[model samples]
Target: MTEAGDDTWLARNRATLARLQFAPQARSVGRVEHVADGIALVSGLPEVRLNELLRFETGQLGFALTLDVEAIGVVLLDQSESICAGARVSGTGEVVRTPVGQGLLGRVVDPLGRPLDRDEALGETVFMPVERAAPAIIERDPVSEPLATGILLIDALFAIGRGQRELIIGDRATGKTSIAVDTIVNQKDSDVICVYVAIGQRATAVQRVIDAVRRHGAPERCVFVVAPAAAPAGLQWIAPFAGMTIAEYFRDQGRHALLVIDDLTRHAATHRELALLTREPPGREAYPGDIFYLHARLLERAAKLSGELGGGSVTALPIAETDAGNLSAYIPTNLISITDGQIVLDAGLFAANQRPAVDVGLSVSRVGGKAQTAALRHASGRLRLDYSQFQELEMFTRFGGITDARISAQIVRGQRIRALIRQARFAPLPESVEVALLGALADGLFDALPPACIATARERLLAGAISGDEAAAVRARLDGIVQDLTREAGHRPSDGASAP
Candidate 1:
């Protein structure tokens, strides 16, 4: 047929089909047997599978959480008040999925990828299952590259690596979220995309985090996934998983990403609530037996891919809350065993005016110096040991016993280190500044000045230091800069002090 004739024929057929009424295919329909507290028991859909999405007559959504012989336990993603017994429910034949892509960056979304911050649509995203298999061991490379948190205590002492899962655990109100937010804020100048997942947090608290990142960090490079306290339990349960899937998209694209679960303790509570609602038997501490497995599977997705897989990575900072500084608690201990290391925050230290409140003795990074930058590793080799000893000696000195000159000097040096590492909420230092400060400490340049002067001198150094683009040149000039600052502060520079 001629081209015009063929087009006309196709148009005629399409118009004819549009006027015809067609019946929908027969789907396995079920009826809700019981409904309560965001969970429903459905019957007559024997083919329903776990994690499968279910549609209710009320236009609400749920997932098949437990498939029993007689009925399927569904966790509703919407308000359960609208759903009632005998409501028609049908399986979607598909697992729960969320939108993933670059379009999600800078957007505040829920666990289901619905935008919460604005009314605009998320443009051009691919839907991916929230639950995915973690990369196999062979597909992952060893984590060696540093992921700087910009907090001197972490970068210099407990170094985190790309693709490593670091746990931040502490009692309530001890700046746990502050550490995570500061880390996200520090990525303003890096290529790393950050995903902050607030699971079961207060609305005001979640808003505070969004505002902090907007003011101090590159919001365009971030994606906030929030399941606030008021959200449905099902959404809270999947918040971390959804955030991880979103971040994995960037990682698969050969880009670096960071995922922060702003606190998983509440997630655990939500899981327990849903499990109870579904009638699942509780285990330790009224939590389900699968609680550990749930988090492990989620965090294992964060890995450094091998060279053949584009060498991308996803670093995770999973926060957990402890009661009364009890590290022996069930959830805290499980997380401590799962992560590469735990950054333990001390409530005592926090109350004592330590801003980050990182407990040096308790916190550790298994990656250690392997993930530390060359400059930082060289300059901070002995810092942890010295500070540890200083803390011990200072505790003893509180009783006012006589001290030797060496002990006195060590105490003074330790106080300076403490002062130097005490950083403000939104201010993250560059590597060059951290190196300079640590190098000066090692050379005893701060010994001549009072501890109160260290903060002023640090501000001076950060304001006047050269760019970090030429690391070697910057390192070479650090000594001279330290000397000049010490001289300007009316303190003699340490004799023969050298740069890192």
Candidate 2:
């Protein structure tokens, strides 16, 4: 059909469509018939509703219709030749990509990068496709760069590097999301660009995240992409890609970007459902066998390409939620294998009120040593050996008094390691604090402090009141606290068989 003829046919079709009341297919696109003052209704579709997805042209522009369905009776937006009538309506062509450019900061966007909050219009975006090839191995630099999170457990023990794939696996309500959020907020002044992709989150939850991100005053440094629970399943599947595309814009300009796919469980689940609907073969739990491939491709996009190419990096922290804290499940294991390393959060530890309650003995950082400083690796490596031996012996000796002085000494060091890593916030620690905490634990500065006093000393150290040589002064005060506690117990080791 000629272009003018097509427009005439579409206009008639839209008139008939408005009178008919039928729900469109789950995945279809429609054109805006009219647009005025940032409000528009698409032609040939039932009045654009509050949550319906709509597109302009074949794929040039798209957004989730945010206006009330009742108010969209017959009015249409954009009377242009292409969007008039009989325009093809289907799911958004290709994944909804983020429009690259400045001012995307501080905006809460849907998977398609449309403004979710209606605060402002996105203008003049430099676009990039969602499905991008991983940078070639030769073009990529090694992950020898450290990205300090400021958490003792992570910085000193499980260091995360730029362009690294670190998995955050945990059961629900274990503060997994909190950890990711805190990390982003703490990067305000660190020159790190952060993108947080919320897949299948609640609308209220997305709002809260936007508020928190704004509160941090790093809107220019952060980009938030949200796919709420009620959005079409296809949107949820594409949310992470949208976030990554935004980060890639900055990284390509020689800037470092940190992309967090918080709770990829939802994305995985959505992909599984789509695979089934498309009649793909099912593997474990009816999930597609190629499930691993989907994740691997997405995560492989993160890399530190050499200066000859971009001189930038995109570090990925992808979180996966497991059932009942079971990492042996199908999805968790698939992700574990694809990523460089995993940070497994323990539910039992969380329940015990261990804020940021990571089970130190259980979590392993395959690339941790490579990402950390020489001093950190040396100190923490020894600390781990000491703590492991003490815990094994403590299990057998807990039934009686003072089994051995050597075992008692080890217990003190073990307790100190735990206390030092205990943090309530997800803020990344300064590099100096990371070194001091590891140094103190290695040197037995914590040997004398009681468990409670040890916790207090850790808080003081992180507060930055003590640093460099002054950290020793704080340790001296802790020594006094320990001596006072030990004196009250008097002659404890002398009477080996006595309980008190």
Q: TM per model?
A: 0.93, 0.75
User: Number of backbone collisions per candidate, in order?
Assistant: 0, 16
lDDT of each: 0.89, 0.69
TM-score of 1: 0.93
Q: Which stretches of candidate 1 lie over 4 Å from their true place?
A: 1-11, 14-25, 469-493, 496-500
lDDT of 1 by residue, 8-109 (tens): 999999999999999987778899999988899999999888999999999999999998888899999988888889999999999989999989989999
Judging by lDDT against the true structure, name the best candidate. Answer: 1
Which candidate has the highest TM-score of all? 1
Deviation (Å) of 169 in candidate 1: 0.8
Pairs with steric clashes in candidate 1:
none
After the best TM-score superposition of candidate 2, give how far the Cα of residue 45 lies from its true spot, in angstroms. 20
